[model samples]
Target: MTNTNNSLNSASSKASPKCWPILPAAGVGSRMQADRPKQYLPLHDQFLMDHTLRLMLSYPKFEQLVLVLSETDPYWPDSAFANDPRIIRAPGGSERCYSVLNGLRALEGMAAEDDWVAVHDVARPCLHHSDLDALFSAVENSAINNTGACGAILASPTRDTMKRGIKQPDGTITIDHTVERDQLWHALTPQVFRYAELKQALEFCLQNHLEVTDEASAMEQVNKQPLLVAGRSDNIKVTRPEDLALAELFLAQSLNQS
Candidate 1:
């Protein structure tokens, strides 16, 4: 909405930015068909969100973490890091974008305009240390290489054949066409960008009634290009009942590898 060029120029001139991790954990996963939110459901003896919180706080160390939670969420107090000094709590919103924006606002006093914010999903409990390392490395290299890349995200190439679906008159679905997977990347979490640019980009999208599914989408609306660094395919977001098992296995695999 504002002068994009001027904002970018000013940000590039600032000192190296620190990455702030923001995890949006407000969704009540109805698809999981569980009694409670998917994030609160048990995963390997602890709440599902506990694994994600631990992963974010431990790897690629930061001063603090902003956890966006629903205002009425009674389960958060039970989290292992609930009383941890490194954690900052922010109220969640109706949608993912709004929740992320609230998390950004939580750092108003501490975060500078050029500071970087890495938005990751709280449901993704199996994020590997290697993926975090790759994502941050790309962000740091972007400036050193003078690539002018506004942001960076962890993504993976689509391995399976993609298809476009079409609804039939009889309430059935059929393949409309086969989509090319060559240039398509399955966007993953830990999408990082400057604090001010991300905030402004999100605000502009909300003002114009645009649908922002992720932080990258908001940045795209402002004509900014983000680098897609390849990441492991196992970084899955636990949304359904069966995903809990998969996440458990992935977590175990990561632990064994470590």
Candidate 2:
């Protein structure tokens, strides 16, 4: 997991051979309104996809990186990830869950049955090393016998009063009520889990005809309330036009810190 620019060492010489990172980058960024996907958007010197790749490639222990992507993307044949010896590409699916399934399918041929996969979105570029540390700590105990577990996105708690509203056809909104400010947590990605556990959850969803929002929701369908490792607010998702600027600022700050 190293090149001339990156220095990496195994956490243990024996090497725990299971856990890896899987990135779902097949989404065409409709919100960005660009012909290209949001992941192809430029952030500083590297493309947004590169930012995501850098995060995992920067880590030393992950043996392989499975990128779930569209075959049609121009970024294909690109060296950002293809240059790495440990990087693998898997064709994406119709939905995020399905894309993950395709990734798991690729892993199924080679990885251990109980291997772990940390699923992350391509748009989230502000993930920190501390957040990664916290997530591993939460499930470190479960790694003992390979009965690995589920863990969710980290996000800062809400400090502002959340408002509920009704949108009218006239382009006006009415505040229905002020939602409770005390109980809210925003979800961000790099959501980690056992590959088999997630595969089970997705299979359950497919059988039950459920369309869940996040990976955690699919797991919840299977009676799993994943542990959340609170990540910083700076870890943001670029889902709308306005978020690009916010993301730019976060990226600037992130580089300065590093």
Candidate 3:
């Protein structure tokens, strides 16, 4: 669980607040219907999380990366990154919010109050570099203007025709109305926020019994509106068996472009 002394330490000594990535990989991922957690599942030749970690570590040089995993998870010891010096391990919690919260708590002594913490989903292995640039630029610009109170996230505007469904007594789902898609956006990770702000927000939600679907939702519960930085639609979360193929394709395309 100890962070290795590396360039990350020197990087954090800079004038600007450093960015620390926290990946909550504790979920069972029941939708994937796999023997192991979706993160541990193979994508191409490497594990899905291997791709995500590589993408993240390649860009932003950080003090350390925090990985929240189930204490009883047997797959992590076999991962390529298991012995990496720059990564720290934290105990997983029951839910996504709890996992994220635990990850934040793991940084209590190491992270400064205003340091940025990007809470990313480990299942999202196809996040593009351009999206990360856009998100970081927006948040840093806002900080310079003293307007980044709510932080920011990479999101894509809804493209498909939206539908609102209602369940019937017979267990059938019927469309209730056509939802307006103009203002809707699919929230994606690398949801960035100040360390203290995000920690407090998640704590507030958990203590109040509020539902926190993501970091932004937790901030929203505390009357904050996070900026939605437009990102590539290809940045998808591998949730089902079919998504693995799609993720692999996207990853290959990203590599070719780079």
Candidate 4:
């Protein structure tokens, strides 16, 4: 078994910025067509959210976890982590950005301005420990390099040939043009940002009515470019029903390797 405490202590000694984890679990999984929220669905005989929570909790560097849940979420109480003292509840908002902001707000008295907040998706249950380590390393390196980067996010360079599509009056879609995939990347979770910087960027976006897809985008709107740290492809977010099987497979494979 991994020595969680030792790992955390090692990371703390090397990493200059303290890190905290924020999980947004307010979505209803509309595309999943499931009876319950996708996070509440079963994965390896446990709630999907349970697996995600355990993964974050295992990281000893994190002082606490801020979980954003919908106000009326009945399944949250049933979660195995609901009673964990390390986990704090935050009221969910209408949009992902709002939910993230709420989670950040909950950290008011606890986290310092320069502390790093790693915002991860609750549905992504297969985040590898190596990826987490890499993310923290990248952020620390940026500070050492004086890159002026506000934060960092886990991302994967696009592998598939890209295309832009256009729909005709006949309802047939055709490629409008080929998109250059060289610089494109699929943004993943555990996006880490300095607490104060992230909060300011998010608030700026909200005030201007800008669409904040991810924390990186919000930072971008404020003229802050966040570093993209490459992560493993296995770190997939469970959206549709079909993704559950793949997540289970990845989790099992990861366990075998460990």
Point to the candidate with the largest lDDT: 4
Ranking by lDDT: 4, 1, 3, 2
Q: Tens digit of lDDT per residue, candidate 4, span 1-258?
A: 379988998888655657889999999999999999999999999999999999999987776899999999999888888899999899999999999999999999888888899999999999988899999888888888988988899999999999999999999999999999998999999999999999999999999999899999999999998998999999999999899999999999988988
Please provide, for model 3 over 58-174, each residue's C-alpha lDDT reduced to its tens digit, 9 standing for 90 to 100.
885565799999999999888888899889899999898999989999998899998999999999999877788899899889877988467999988999999999999999999
Per-residue lDDT of model 1, residues 1-258, tens digit only: 369988887776665677799999888999999999999999889999999988888875577899999999999889888899999999999999999999999999999888889899889998888888888889888877989899899998999999999999999999999999898999999899989999999999999999898999999999999999999889998988888999999998878888
Off by over 4 Å in 1: 1-14
Better of 2 and 4 by TM-score: 4
**Count of steric clashes across candidates, in order:** 0, 1, 0, 0
RMSD of each: 6.1, 6.4, 5.5, 5.7
Against the reference, the lDDT scores of all candidates come to 0.90, 0.78, 0.90, 0.93
Whole-structure CA lDDT of model 3: 0.90
> Model 4 lDDT vs. the true structure?
0.93
> Looking at candidate 1, what is the lDDT of residue 257?
81
lDDT of 2: 0.78
Looking at model 1, residue 58 earns an lDDT score of: 84
Better of 1 and 2 by TM-score: 1
Q: After superposition, how far is residue 216 of candidate 3 from its true place, in Å?
A: 0.2
For model 4, the stretches where C-alpha displacement exceeds 4 angstroms are 1-16
Task: Name the runs in model 3 displaced over 4 angstroms.
Answer: 1-15
